[model samples]
Target: MRLEAVGRRYRARGPWVLRGIDLDVPEGALLRVEGGNGSGKSTLLRLLAGIDVPTTGRITGRPRTAYVPERFAATLPFDAAGYLVHMGRVHGLCGRQAAARTEEWLERFGITGFAGTALDRLSKGTAQKVAVAQALLAEPELLVLDEAWAGLDTAARALLDEAVTERVAAGGTAVYVDHDPRRLAEAVPRRHRVAAGRLTDGPGGADEMARVVIEAEGTGEPPAALPPHSWTAGPAAGAPGLLRIRVPADRADAALRALLDADPPWHIRAVRSTGGTSPSGAVR
Candidate 1:
């Protein structure tokens, strides 16, 4: 699957959200899209999924690509199992085959009880699990996810992580968006960031280690108030609302914990680290 020079603009918007984005995704590959909010990562995924057309550029790939967005689309009024079966049928599975596969995915995602319950009645997280199941039921050649990990707890995250790994091992390609660099690194994924209408590997490609860069932003916040060297105050290009902190290759984990414990208003929107050994195995 490939998207070359892809771009999108909403209703004559002044700036392009996705500009000249290009990517080549091969079978069995998992690519993580990392970027700050409004950076157009989700838009790029949507375009690739064929949910929306690109204003410029071209995408070439098999039609079996599937996408799971941040907000799971509401299922028609039906029990969870019914919905799964419906989705499977849409993917071309016959009755018995669809039922068997739905059962397997429901258990795999740990949402079995939801089988008899209405999808709308389930919690947000539970609903997402079904959406994930729907996406995987077809076992598409290419899977695209947008912020799929945001609301999930540790266990759920781990489950999906394993599933994604297994899928790739079975010759499937995936495009996923999430905030966890450590998870992405664990998968040995190819990482890219969408910024200023372009996508780049940004300091690391497929072989580099994962790095997390946290920045403090907001008015009247002291950059020096945080740990020295590990956190610094600076302007991030095209991001005036950000105070950048470039985590050293050796200090990422501890630095991240320190920042989390500190509970600063600033949050890590994207990771800019390549891989290296970290101090005390913290975040290197």
Candidate 2:
């Protein structure tokens, strides 16, 4: 999806909330939008989600979209499961499919016990879970989250993070706004900031940082001084004792040195860049 010189304002002559904006929402991409309060971040998200129309310019190639706004209506009449099923149907799922997805997301969000409870009867956090679940149930091509993590519990927040990653990995696009800078930090995602009704690239823009993935293993624990901004995870399925580390391209050498210098030393299996060929100094 793409936005070309998009602009928005409330009234015929009202001051613009966003203006002269151009953006590309590519498939399989994770994008973060940031800004101070009243800086029009939400407006841009709304436009991306097709919740609000642009007052000027054109937006093209929008796909099946879902949005979770900053606030959800907790007073809706339907029970949680019923509301989600209804939303799934609205997103074009069949009845049985909708019900199945409703159950799936309820369990994923750890809210299966609240399935039969009325929306208005749920607590704020549970209500937020419902809001998030509704959006995810559809597996939308475009997901727009406006502080969708605010009221979620820690577990739920983590689940949402995984869900967003899954969506992007599945060839969907996710555009979100969150107050936490550490959100999806491991992805090293593309970022943009809104200020004075305009959008600009943020720090760590996609082109500015390339990532390197290192696969290694050792009996001892990892080094205490791993490179900054790097993250480690357990190896892929069937690879016990293996560790996967991702670091910025520039720090790949430092991370490899740290792992190799550790007690008992880590054995390097592979090192490759996420965006192209193996980086320089990669070990096999």
Over 4 Å off, model 1: 206-284
Go through the candidates in order and give the clash count of each.
5, 0
Q: What are the per-residue Cα lDDT tens digits for candidate 1 across 124-204?
A: 888888888888888777888887876776888887776676565444677888877786564456788887778888545
Worst 10 residues of 1 by lDDT: 229-238
lDDT values for all models: 0.70, 0.84
lDDT of 2 by residue, 108-195 (tens): 8888999999999999999999999999998899999999999999999999998887666445678999999999877667889999
Give candidate 2 misplaced runs (Cα > 4 Å).
209-284
For every model shown, what is its TM-score relative to the native structure?
0.70, 0.76
Best by TM-score: 2
Angstrom error of the Cα, residue 202, model 2: value is 0.5
Instruction: Name the lDDT value of residue 138 in candidate 2.
Output: 88
Pairs of colliding residues, candidate 2? none
